[model samples]
Target: MILRTEIATILKAPPIGETVTVMGWVRAWRGNRFMVLNDGSSAETLQVVVDGEQFDEETIRGIGFHAAVSVTGELVESQGAGQAVEVIAKELTILGKTDLSTYPLQPKRQTMEFLRENGQFRMRTNTFSSVFRLRHAVAFAINKYFNDRGFYYLHTPIITGNDAEGAGEMFRVTTFEPDSAPRDEAGAVDYGQDFFGKGTHLTVSGQLQAEIGALALGKVYTFGPTFRAENSNTSRHLAEFWMIEPEIAFADIDNDMDLAEDFCKYLITYCLENYLSDLEYLDARIVEAEKNLPKDKRRPMGLLEMLRFVVEDDFARITYTEAIDLIMRSKPYKKGRFEFPVSWGVDLQAEHERWLVEKHFKKPVIVRDYPKDIKAFYMRLNDDDKTVAAMDVLFPYIGEVIGGSQREEREDVLRQRMQEMGVHEEELAWYLQLRTFGGAPHAGFGLGFERMVQFITGMGNIRDVIPFPRAPRLADF
Candidate 1:
């Protein structure tokens, strides 16, 4: 019986003179003897050698690029440079074959745009494989972090009756045919006749449901897919993405910031320690990709250095009002470098956020106490009556990594804010009930999973980090 081994494992410590079977797709076939094999197990590939005397010429030529094959061989010291060991094939079985003419992924370097169009096969590429592997590491680290911290993992519903963000940017879920939907006397589509008997939509955030779990269980978190129907075609926005929302009972906004900081640092430190090889690969890619850029625009630190900086350094903590003040007095605002002019009460654009994290602070920043008018209705109202206890965690390359706040636990204030925000309280009666009875101070935050992956992988576009990106006009796998 041939012992099957993953290419990643075999490449780690090649067993000289040991018989083994390597099953993988042929990455490249050079001459009649050498073949590079990859099994989606790691960023590294294993080199397979076919003895022309033992293997027939027809069988050798049949091993096409990306063809699934199993090679039983003796692991011997490599006669060539680069790799330490090579497999001397004694038997070769072709599992599957691909037509090179139709294949989108070639052995040569392909552009990110081309890879995106062929996202289905992008994982086979070194760059994307590294990104996806790092993404997995980040996700695992998050689950481990919260799991070790005595937090319950809550699974929230994907379909909901009320918009969690209250932004109304939700994809309506209905069985009714839109062209022939039931109409009322007012000539409107009657949602009452729908399958759910009420208007429902894809959830925009899981923070509300997670809050319920936190109240009962003390500390809880939700890691699930969330949808937004915004038609933004930017690099930051996504139509469908994953969110990491952690809610804690008896916790204030300060506690929220503490958790956010620790959580982000944990993820960064975990990735750096566990995924150094893949990260180093991605870091090299970033360096090469940015080589042609202007000196001023190039990233100051490589991917590894950036991760270390976040992990080792303390995040700058400042209030939103103070950030605005700093921006107003800074050279960027004075020189009109900001695309959106900075002012108090104005929402900070990506430029402003980059200025704080990348330029001004030069580290991860926690900006809290945003103007209540610019924040969600559920945020705790501060004593100033104008600002809410909202905090946003900003990273160097990525602007807003996490957005959260202390929930408005006071029933009266919540109702007034809901009314002012024109949220139908009747639809959210259950959410209001949490505040009405035995409520304690609670806080939570939402972290964009893909954005975090993009930052760690050094990928420019959000679509590149996600496995199957769902964005404006592009949902193809």
Candidate 2:
């Protein structure tokens, strides 16, 4: 049997008269003459010319949309316009014939929601294939970016006893029967009798554990799945998502912000340089998607334009205080356009952040020194005692892409912050000991992998960026 060449490879360098075997699903079988095939290798598909007279009735009958097939043919320059080369099929074998009457997908345009419901076949579509390809590109760029910078990739535990964010929203990890489990004297479920001998839940973030690695290894990162049990079913929220967190020792808030900006630009630039085809497809996808929307509702720039602008421009940096002041002084706030109320101590909502990035700065913005009360317990306390040395990197479409802080390394201060935030010190004794033993000033931030993908791909929903999305009342394959 002859080896099969990938459509992507053949398309990249066409051997004008060489015979090659290609295997892929039929994207389209037009008038029983031309078979468009794609093997998920690249966004482009290949045209295989089939002579109805040369093929028997059975072989011709087997060819249809999405039917798996292998073609042994002579490669030649195309007489067509869209593609440069074509395959003249000398032999055709049906690998798997699809019964189109029952198949969920069609060649025509389908709604995203409908496509999402049929996720098993969604990748076969152009939009999703491009999305997942760029998704892979971004993942590769993430590891490459960190590895090139001398950062080790650390795998944090998925089932963790510690809630790094102290948000009390976590998916419980238990082997016990939920309705009939051991109970303590207080009538609470006896977590001590459970799998790990105590309460444990899916980790919300890997920043805390990555800090340990950073303390020992100088620089480390964790890129893995993190879960949250929050009931939000919005476009931006996901029950399970991947996080890329990098922790660096001896780094303060300034260093953290600089790293965040540089790292983001690098990811975008890498995609632009290497995966322009996929990006171009997604870019055109957005342009076609937003054609009907009102002028103000549409994006200010096209996807490629926006991505290049982000990579070329410098991110604006300001304190949370300055951000708040700017928002308050903006015309929208003056006209009471925002739905969420903005105040000094309260957390900044997405609307507020969007205003700062999209309307005010006209570029990516990093807002630092958020009020201590609105931040996590581990963030370093500023000298003013009112704010923490924290920062959030905001982009045009996605409000916050990265959030990080210079950790509170002072053992006493961490203890006080824990108590103030209602987190039990006994539960994190080892965490405190890290500070007591050899903890240096460390900083790290987490980039929501799906959010960055969504931003880069111009995907409207966070769920669409991930292959299998987990959301409220959603766990479909």
lDDT of 1 by residue, 323-380 (tens): 9999999997999887898788899987888889878888889999999999999999
Candidate 2 residues lying further than 4 Å off, grouped into runs, are none
Model 2 per-residue lDDT tens digits across residues 296-379: 888878999889878988999999999989888889999999998877998888889888887888888999999999999999
lDDT of 2: 0.92
Model 2: per-residue Cα lDDT at residue 471? 95
| lDDT values for all models | 0.90, 0.92
TM-score of 2: 0.97
Off by over 4 Å in 1: 1-3, 30-32
Cα deviation in Å at residue 360, candidate 2?
1.8
Cα-based lDDT at residue 459, candidate 2: 89
Q: Residue 397 in model 1: shift from native, Å?
A: 1.3
